[model samples]
Target: MTDQLTQVIAQATLKDGMRNSTDSLDAATHSAKKLARKLFEGLDEDKGGVLTRDEFEPYFKNPADAAEAFKVFDKDGNGDIDRKEMRNAVSRIYRERRALATSLKDMSSAVSKLDGVLLGLALLITIFIWLFIFNPKGTTAQLVPMATIILGFSFVFGNAAKNLFESMLFIFSIHPYDVRDLIFIDDSPMFVLEFGLFSTTFQRCDGQVIVAPNSVLFGKKYILNVRRSGPMWEATKVMVSFDTPLDVLHEFRTRLRQFVTDHPREWKGGLDVNIDFMQNQNLIQLSLIPSLVVAMEHKSNWQDWGARWDRRTLLMKEMKRIMDQLNMTYKLPTQPVSFMSGQNKSPKPANSLLGAR
Candidate 1:
């Protein structure tokens, strides 16, 4: 079977003389699906057509770990994984592996830039030191004038020198964020564009460029590195009337879960739909917070901002559809109106109104 499958894939790749790039992509996808099928079949030792927890125990030493892995593969909480679910799980893993590879490449590029900058600085410093130590004209008296000039310049730019030193320290010691990293500065998402000795350049999702001094960023009490931390969790609240039927609420949660399940590539596996809070003071409104794994699509962390908003918008539209179909009622808080002691509750008679003829 393996030899036959390989032959089929090879034929698909080397098909008729008129093959194009799309043919190659199709062949690759076919090969991946075949491999996924093979893996799934191998795991079904009992030939039961579905994978059970026992089939996974040998690979995972801890029973709890095995159960968790099983749960991921079993998309419908069916306690067993069918061929279709296994294939989906395998595809997800493939995408994650590709994403990891891209992230590593980004890190490598960032480090290369850092190395180049450091090397340039080191060479410049070494040139000055070499000239001072191995001066062809070796008299201390000969260098006194140059030394005086250097001192004068240093004194004139003392503050700049201090900032340079501090910037160097920030680069070497802190290492909080890297080029192409998504970071939050003053609650705004900033994509690190270039890391310079004195200042760093950042770009916002809307394409605004910001150049901030290294001292300013380094002195901040906190920096949120979104990429290094992995995916973020975001929640959307839905306000519904407290009197909504239990069955309707159950269906609401089920539909949302189904949506997430249908888009495994866009959202993480699980979701949290719970009662967030209630407003009983002014109105009776129940807030249901459905927390999801923030959608971060691109290998570059900067793209996460756009992807997150896009996913949220999609989820909100889905929620609106579900609410409309279920006929769920959302209640708004009521406000009280107060009138002054002498104020007329009704408008003056039509004849007495301003500008009356």
Candidate 2:
């Protein structure tokens, strides 16, 4: 079977004249299938019509042809062949031949590629011969030192160059995020300070600078928070004792929201402020931590980041003052643990819980 398959492939090579042809991998695979089918049709010893592994072993010498032949005839691809499938395989072979015969573009494309290959080879040989005859060894080396340098550089920095270029293209073309636009890269919130040719500069809240190579940034995805329709939202949160009246908390939140909404332009319009109850603010176990959420619009310097910071600082201060004015209970961190000593200690409803701590 192996020798017969080899002879069939050899006959196909001669019949199709692929030895001097510019056939693609698909074309070569098709040719192999044709050759296998041609050989299979002639095998009739101990065969029940369909070509199984046992029946196919008599004709398919090459493993590749055998595999391809099985795939061609296995129409339903259940890994076996039937009489109907074997018959249909003949039609497929005929159709493939007819299609190839009628495909002028395929023929032209093959011829054009063949011409190009031949011309390129001829030119390369001509240049090599001329260089050998007329050009000195030193002259050849000197002329191509630049090409060598470029090749050497590519070997060293090709990936970096590709990444940097892609990053630059992304920065300028896609505009993923711009300067002053808040973004998170690698879980760190950063303000984009500058976008450079090969790196990006970011400024953290502590005045520390972060210099990331463009390649590093390009390699990882980022969380981009930008505004198109309106000013970006800034969320603030503060925790307070549960002793604070719910009505007072609600009033404070309502006042803040109304203040921002009434003068929309001052807060950059469409001020959507929210204050909600939260579980213990800290992740560690604490129940009814009674947290206050704040989202308010403010008018301030977007460029300097002072507006948001100033507004946040002032709002925190005012909220603290309001809580104090209302005489709602709160505690200082350094307050002595006199209650622990039971010295002049009495049961105070507000101070009985961990909120005091």
Candidate 3:
């Protein structure tokens, strides 16, 4: 079966011009495998995995080749092919073809670009040889000094060029963010608007655009991609006086949960409310982490941001209503001040040498 399959694949490769007549056995075999998988799946009628000799005949000009292909595909000596057998036979073939195509495309691109450079190098080499053969002493004297200057110049500026090279690497390889993606750089949220080879343009929420080099972005502490993250909790902190009862805090949590439940579209199903901290026996800081539903269907991050902003306003308003219902008062910090009864009297001097004088 192996020998017959190899023969059929070789014949197909030759016919398709995928393998030249003078090609080595290994080269022909490798090329034959890529083209065979493309033909392997096309003959299946009724979208079924099995391919009888009749179904394979139209793909091949000769009936003998079709019969041979059926025997190779039909494992376990079963008259029909099943999905398992098809998977085992064609999966590796498809992978090899895809990999070979990608490698060839990359190689062709690299070689095409270098072709011009190589031609120019060849011309320069020919001229150099002619000059050396005719006037070796003078040519050597001139070339040595020219090469030294070029080396020194490169050494002086190579560090500066490294930044540009790193920028290219960041843009092409790391790919930290894409256009329209909402990312936080240095804790400031910005929307990516454009991507250049060496720099990226970002738009702040306040409508300011920043063009930062890729190298600079790569050096930041961290870049947070909001678009790639899950729904985030919107926190609202409130200070309540120590006199407030525990029952009131419990009621606030319950009401906040109910609000999230009622507005299912704007908020997620769950929430958290807790006493985050307490001041010096004065007030308790209550923290609410209300999970805001991410607007994934929006056209852009800006639209999503706007939608979240409105939802936050609604949440705050609902919170205010709940607080008003429970008669909850905010505990604002106070400062003590003293006023003198006699405004016209002179101020007292400090208790120092100046006061004694």
Candidate number achieving the greatest lDDT relative to the actual structure: 1
Candidate 2 regions with alpha-carbon error over 4 angstroms:
1-154, 177-194, 203-209, 221-229, 261-265, 268-303, 331-357
Candidate 3 on 21-91: residue-level lDDT in tens?
Answer: 44543554554454444445665666665667788777677999988877665543446665544544543
Each model's number of backbone clashes? Answer: 0, 1, 0
Q: Give TM per candidate.
A: 0.52, 0.39, 0.55
Q: Rank candidates by TM-score, best first.
A: 3, 1, 2
lDDT of 2 by residue, 123-147 (tens): 9779777877787685577658757
- Better candidate number, 1 or 3, judged by TM-score: 3
The local lDDT score (0 to 100) that residue 325 gets in candidate 3 is: 91
Please identify which of the two predictions, 2 or 3, would achieve the higher lDDT against the true structure: 3
lDDT of each residue in 125-178, candidate 1, tens digit only: 797678778885664566788788889988998887677667777876787776
| lDDT, candidates in the order shown | 0.67, 0.52, 0.66
Q: Give the TM-score comparing model 1 with the true structure, all chains together.
A: 0.52
Tell me the lDDT of candidate 2.
0.52
The alpha-carbon lDDT assigned to residue 148 of candidate 1 equals 89
- Model 1 stretches astray by more than 4 angstroms: 1-155, 245-247, 281-302, 333-357
The stretch of ten residues in a row with the least summed lDDT in candidate 2 is: 290-299
